[model samples]
Target chain A: MTKLLLKKLTKTFERRVIFKDINLEWNGPGLFGIAGPNGSGKSTLVKVVTGLISATAGEITIETDGKKLSPSTAIDYIGFASPYLTLYDEFTAKENLEFAVNIRGQQLDEAKMDQLLEHFSLLKRKNDFVKAYSSGMKQRLKIIFAFIHNPDMIILDEPTANLDAEGKQKVYDLVKQTAKEKMVIFATNEEEELAMCDEIIKILSYQPAGRN
Target chain B: MFRRALWLFNKDLTSELRTRYAINALAMFIIVTISVIMFAIGQETISAALAGGLLWVVIFFSAMSGLSRAFVSEEERGTSLLLQLVASPTVVLTGKLFYNLILVFAMNMVILVLYSALFDAFVLKNVYIFFFSFVLGNTGLAFASTIIASIIAKANSKGTLYPVLSFPILLPLLLMLVEITKRCSEGVKFEDIAPEFFALVSYNVVIAAVSYMLFDFIWKE
Candidate 1:
């Protein structure tokens, strides 16, 4: 179905080329991983894919029901999460989820939200402000908020960075379960996490010999 | 669109309710600044002539501190990216502007009371003109604050950069506000200040439209 496609994408910062003539595609439901070392533009690639930043030169297209979607319209179908992103600390988990739904013009069903909370083992802390929750709990809440609207494509950057063993398993299970209907793309350097991916793309940096 | 605005407004309101730091700082600053002004003009028979300019200076600096923190708080907590991903930039900016307008409006009222108490300023006989000046002035402040905050949100020294960037663009609005305020404080009729008031309104409208159009681009980074 080619949910997303990027053609000849290029980006530069302060006259330094990040990537040139980059092309990628996501055709269907599966887990895709982008692996690279620090400063390799993995995060920049994700940002361009999400349309958070425009490529210096390229076209990004999204397909839904055999129709091409514009960048602004495509945002509704994309759910994104990153380690640097956080939910409102003053908001309870439920309130945070409600806000996400409200912005998307959807009503929050109490029973459904409760089920999601229970799935993440956050039902007991549903009313607690996110600031009071542990880091792992906040991460779980972010995931729940991202998926609450049932987005067709989910992009996660360093999704498992701060999780313990149990938290990691829960996210892994969620990713696998979500892959049944939506494409999941994760960017990370951890080999263990790469084991769950259906495809892995490694990004390499170009270095001049003897320049180091 | 309005629902998204409401969500952001509620989010900020809840946060402010929990902290109360912006309001407390602004209120105390206003009180101290006004007290100093009173001492400087002691027994000089403070004229309604100077009341409008004095009141706005108090509100402007107070808003400078309070409104600049609006988006910085989001960035500090790392929630801004989440907000950008979930809501349209127009909605986000509108929500923040609306919240700041309410905060500044409250501060304006408090300043009015404190100005009267400290300097024995007379009651504003031209109530409509006074209200008009306050709304116009606050709109300009909110517009400038939101745009400047977006620019400096990525900078390392946002606290100092905010006012430096905003003051230049806001100068015209400040001048218009002072003229309208000066006329109203002198118990002049609304017709007498209509030209200045209209100019102030036009200034606010133009800036608000421009800022709204450019906000999505500015917030993209």
Candidate 2:
């Protein structure tokens, strides 16, 4: 079980407000969505929540299994997958996964690796260089990389960005399966994707009251 | 963290072998610079001090060419985010630092052999001082270069920013290296260069400690 609470969250870029005064309490073991139109601080909010970027003024308290986590170790419990993140193309998918697993000081578990590779339909091509994989395949590999460590919270920004209908279905199914045990923050505006969420948080673009 | 750093080192070694990006740049730079030096010094006898100075020039420039590749590759390939997500800042910095250390040590040893082979004045009567300076110099070079490389990787003009940042930061260390090299090649005894050895070790420690403290912010931000 994981809990995230954001208090008075405000983000500004060079005096230009992106979002402000956003307070939310999010709990997981269920699917949640952060829905916003394009350029409405969706990715920024996602990045902030994941501690990839700092909030301008707010507090993000992340508690997993009833223990409060500091910033340094918060990421240890987070599995982040996004288009903004990429795998090493110079490496084969297997080596890339191995590096990812090993870099966290955890040895790669062959059985879990096989299960994830098969889940993403990447088992057959695990030995192939990621450069040779299609974008959809690359996206699948990213998903496997994220889940390999069995993180407490899984955050996916624009999760279905490059997927075909079949790939999208696979993701929806995976999310369904994952949400049964792990917290999934699905950041997207797609109606179909949002509909699967147990709750949706809207982020509207910020405009000052006096501005036209 | 140590094991993870080793994994990263191996990953980098594999990538470097396949791409040869830094290796080619370093090789070409060394060959061209040495050739130019050979031409410039033709028919004129130079002191070992001057030879030592020239050798360090090659080292500094070679590092400028190759060392930044460690962090810059992560940025260029868009794998920086993945790395950020997977590892702690300490892990990332330690791992990259190890890779850079290996590169600096290997490149300088190659430069040392090549420089020794090409110059008649490059004598080493005090092998002990040369040994101490060589090891310490390479360590300091890698430490300072690793931090600066991470900085320049974030800059808009990466190519120009590296040397512009490295030159001033490395000036003190480079001066000590040249001085020790000159003394070593001139057959000065090892005991006389104690102060140089101390400075070199301190330089490496200070850079390593400061870089460790600051990398978290540089990396996360």
Candidate 3:
């Protein structure tokens, strides 16, 4: 139902090349992974995929239901979670969720909210300010936030960075359930997590073609 | 977009209540500056024009202190990414602008009351004109400040950049506000001050339109 295509993608910061000449096409429903060592552009590639940062050069086209979407419109289809992204620390978890949902113009799906909270074991602490949450709890909250809209494309960078084993299992289960009918892109160095992907792209592979 | 803006406004209000960041900064600057001015003029009667200009000077600096944090705080807290991912640029801009508008209006009303009582600057016949001018002026201030806040949010030296960017853009608006305030103090008729009103309204519309057109690039970049 959704497809993503990147053509000759190049990204550079201050004349230092991050990656170049990347081309790929992905169609959901499946799990895709972007894997690389640290500083190998794994995060940058994920950011590019989610439109969080502009590429130095290239084109990204997202098609849904066979309609090609412009970059601005394509953004609505993406849901992203990253260690770099932050929630409102001053707001309670429920208030944060409400704010996110309201901004997206979606009705509050209380059933889904209850399920996610119970699944993450956060139902009791939903009224607590996010600043009070532990890093693992915050990670679960971020993952939950990404799925709030049930977006056509979900991108998670360092998805399990600080999560405990139990949290990791919850995330893996959520990804499996999500990728069954949507595009899920995970950018991580962990081989265990990458093993879940149907396909993997090493970010290093796109490094300035043939330059060694 | 409007609904989203309201939601953001509420979020800002609640966050402000908890942290007291912008409000505390604005309140401190306002109280300190006004008290200093009152002491400086100790028993010295100043002209309406001088009083009007001083009022604007206090307000402009107070706004510069508080409104710059509208976007800067988001950037510092890393919440801008969350907003960028979930909301459109227009929606984000509208939300920030509304919050700034509420802050500026409320702060200005407090300043107006204090200036009137403390400095004897309320000797005007046409109070309605003053009220309208204050509303329109704050609207323009809100528009310019919100956009500038976003511009400076990404800069390395935000504290310096915010005021530098705001000064030139707000100069004309400030001039018009000062002129209108002076006229109001003198009990000038509404017809005599229509041009100033028109200028303030036009300034708000132009700044808002330009900011809306430019915000997508600024916000995403």
Candidate 4:
């Protein structure tokens, strides 16, 4: 079943058209990459899909358990991460994870949080304030917080933007692993990241064509 | 929903407990402001009227400083996005507002104590009236700060904008707060101050609802 579907998605900023009539869909349990250059509305596209921003004109529907979810109701199954968004710096990794779990109305799974910390190679720094973390460390923590609840669809924008070789590999592995059970929408410009995608969609620049 | 607010409250409390920057800055600002006021007034009558105004002036300025930093730690570490994505905007605002209320409330208590001590004033003749005034004042402070913080979050010169945007909107509430506090300080009965108290309460409710509805719009931007 299609987990998320966007039809005729259009967004404008300050009377300038960023993108229009954009159509996209995602079914579960696969890797989908949105490949584009800078200024291609990639991040905006992700934001619209996650309902972070409203579209100027279009419809977004999320299908789960044979039911179509509205925007407010659709949030429960979507986990989103971007460099532009991050966790609280004053909070320890453990505290941040616990807060995320709390918002989901679920009990804190200390064991799972610890495992994620270890998986991200942040176990040693789990107790430190995020302000004290490196850029790469902060990015990893953001991803961890997104996945802590095991949402059915994970939307990540430029997931490897600030990482070193080891950090990049860890994220690649994490995305690959997550794709086994949840639909993963990864938006990036790096060819290396795109090489791992099961399917790729290139966002084309605007061209004046005959009206339908 | 309350649980989510509590979670945010505890998270903020624990973090502030660890660093102590927000509370410490607010306390120092309050103390220094109070000391300056005492020196300026020099032992003159220091009317109950002026004392109440001074008390809120100290809180309002100190709270702007404290509340601006409330989101700094989150934004600096990129955790604010995590916060936004994990919970709905309403939930995020609720959590943030709740945490900020605690910070502002604590600061109010400290300011009240110090103001009473320095002014040689005994304002607690009716504990219930005093408590009601404090709650209304704190609610107004928290609600206004929450909306202003979101506005300042994205601005480059937030330092200048925070007070400029917040104070104008908050002036009426501040006036009401000081009026009720002054009346209570003079042993005025609850009924005497009821109208002002209700006005402050309504201000708080209206601002809270408006901010809550508008938060999603601001958060997305």
Candidate 5:
């Protein structure tokens, strides 16, 4: 099990305040959602949680079995998927997955890779370069990369963007199944995705509390 | 870490083979610059010192054209975020450094062969001195270039910043390379060039070590 804690989290860009004085914790075995409207710092919050971006103030700590994981090493245990994070366009689907697995320092689960590709209906196009993939197909591939490692923490930012009905259903199923024994955090404005979560943290409610 | 670096290096190599963005930039710049030099110095009997300086100038510009793409491509493609989340900064830097080193060496060899053939005065008296200086100079060049590429990848004015930032850092290294190559052209022995050889070695070591230490912050920031 993994536990994530955020204490007095605040993020400011220039003079604009995105979120302030936010405190939250999730000891997860279920889906947790961070819901906010467009440009309400949903992606920024997710980036901070994943340590891709630093917060202006506060600390984020990930602990497993009473051992704390530093932000520097948080990525090893986290899987992140977002529209802003693109795969290598010049590489085929399989090559991109190989690249990701290599960098993640994880064994290439050939069986699992094929299974996921088949599940996502992408097995036929696995040899084609990602540059040829449609937006929806690319989105599905991103989700596939995130889950390939079966990481301890799964973070999906705008998970269902550009997905068709069937593709959306496929992601929902995987999120449901994986969250059973891992940490899953979804950042989306879509109520449909939020409804799947065990709890929802609204960004608007995180307005500066007592200016601290 | 080495495995991951190799993976990154291979990824860049494969991509370069497919797109040829960096290679094209390097080849065009090298060919055009060398052609211009050959034309301007058609019948002049240039001294070995001048020839050596001219050779390093060609390498310096060629490196500038090619190495800037190391990190800029990732930022442009939006793959920077994915790489940041997946790989350690050291691994990324190592991969980029290796790629740049290969590129610099290959380009330098082309320039060396062409420069010697085109200019009769570009004779090397000591092959050993020239070879070691060439290798070490390229190593230092790649190390500094890779880190500077990473720093400028996040800047607003990427194209302008690359050469501007690289010029100051690479000036001293270029001077040493030019001096050692000049001695080689003058038929100086390896023992005679020891001071310059040691200076080149020290420069490469210092640049590599400092770049490795500073890259994490630049990469993460």
Candidate 6:
């Protein structure tokens, strides 16, 4: 099990305060949602939690099996998929997954990779270059990159932005199943996705007085 | 760390082989710069100092064109976040550093062979001094260039920003390399180039250490 805590977290860009004094304690074998209107600091919070961007103030703590992770090594235990993140287009789907796994200091298990590809219905195109994949396919591959490592937590930012209805279902199903064993956090504006969350973090509540 | 770094290096090599962006840019710049030099020098007999200085000038500008792609491509392709999410800042820097090392080394040796063959005046009597300078020079160049590439990758006007940022950072290394090359062409003994060799070593060591420390800040921001 994974336990995540955010204590008085704040983020600012230049003079604009993105979010202020946000705190949450989520211990999960379930899904958590971050819901806010456009530009409401949902993605900012996700970046902070994932350590992609540093928090302006306060602290974030992650623990798995009662062992606390230091800030530097915390990223290794979290899987993050973002709209702004992309795979190496020059590589095949399998090769891209291999690189992701290898870079994380683990060898790729071909059977697991093949299983994930099959589950995502990308098995036929497994050997094709990511650049040749459609937007939906690329998004699916991004999802695989996040899940292949089986991190303690999985964070998705705008997870369904490019997906069609069927692609959305595949991701939703995987997130639901994965949540039984790992922490799942979604930063999304979609009502369907929001409905699936066990707890919701609304960015507006953390907004500074005048900004909201 | 080394294993992860090697994964990144291998991934980059595969991507590079497919796209050929860096190799193409380096090759094109080297050929054009050397050809232009030949045309400008025509029948004139150039001095060893001029040839040595011109050699690194080509390399400096060529590096400005090619090595910037090391980090700039990741930023452009929006894969910087993927790397940050997967690897630590040090591993990312070391991976890109080694890739640039291979590239600059290969590019420098090619340019050296061609520069020596064409100039005639820049003949190296002490291959040992030239070899030491070549290894040290490429290491320092790659070290400095990789860090600068990460900085400029985040800037607004990336193209014009690279050389402007790189020239200042790389000036000390360039000056030392030029002098070493000049001495090598003049048939100077290895010991005679000790001060310069040691200077190159210091420049490389300092730059390598500073780059590792500073890269974490540059990369995460």
Q: Which one wins by TM-score: 1 or 6?
A: 6
Give the per-residue lDDT of model 5 (tens digit) for A1-212. 88989999999988788998789999987899999888788899999998888899998988866779886677778899987779999999999998888776778898999999999999999999999999999999999999887788999999999998999999999899999999899999887999999988998734445875
Q: After superposing candidate 4, which stretches have Cα over 4 Å from the reference? A: A128-132, A164-166, A207-212, B72-77, B121-127
Q: Look at candidate 4 and give me any clashing residue pairs.
A: A86-B78, A86-B79, A86-B81, A86-B82, A87-B78, A87-B79, A88-B79
Higher-scoring candidate on DockQ, 5 or 6: 6
Best by DockQ: 6
lDDT of 1 by residue, A1-212 (tens): 43777788888886778877777887768899988899888899888888778889988888866778777666678888787887877778988898888876678888878877888899999999888999988888877776788888888888876788888888888889998878889989888878889888787764534877
The lDDT for every candidate, in the order shown, is 0.81, 0.89, 0.88, 0.81, 0.89, 0.90
Q: In TM-score terms, which candidate is top?
A: 2
Error of 2 at B186 (Å): 2.4
Candidate 4's DockQ is 0.59
Tens-place lDDT digits, model 5, residues B105-149: 898999999888888878888898788888999899989999899
Q: Over the stretch B135-157, how does candidate 1's per-residue lDDT look in tens digits?
A: 77877777887778777888899
Instruction: Evaluate fnat for each of the predicted models and list the values in order.
Output: 0.62, 0.86, 0.88, 0.66, 0.80, 0.90
Residues forming the 10-long window of minimal summed lDDT in candidate 5 chain B = B212-221
- Please give the lDDT score at residue B57 for candidate 6: 93
Enumerate the candidates' DockQ scores in order. Answer: 0.67, 0.80, 0.77, 0.59, 0.77, 0.86
Chain A (alone) TM-scores for all candidate structures? 0.92, 0.97, 0.94, 0.93, 0.95, 0.96
In model 2, pairs of residues that clash are none
Q: B95-115 in candidate 2: lDDT tens per residue?
A: 888888889988988888899
| Tens digit per residue, CA lDDT, model 6, B1-221 | 99899888998888899999899999999999999989999999988888889999989988988998899999998889888988999889989998999999999989988987888877777788888888988999999999999999988899899999888889999999889888887889877888888989999999999998898889898
Score chain A of model 1 by TM-score against the reference chain A.
0.92
Distance from true location, Cα of A138 in model 5, Å:
0.3
Q: In candidate 6 chain B, where is summed lDDT lowest over 10 consecutive residues?
A: B121-130
lDDT string for model 4 (A93-151, tens) is 78778878887677877788888889889999998987899899988998887788878
* Candidate structures ordered by DockQ, highest first: 6, 2, 5, 3, 1, 4
Which wins on lDDT, candidate 3 or candidate 6?
A: 6
Query: What global local distance difference test value does model 1 have?
Result: 0.81
Q: Write the per-residue lDDT of candidate 3 for residues A1-212, one digit (tens) a residue.
A: 88989899989888689988889998888999998878889888878877778999998888877998776666567778888889999998888887877777777787888789889999999999999999999999999888876688889999898899999999999999999999999999888889999988887734554676
Error of 1 at B106 (Å): 1.2
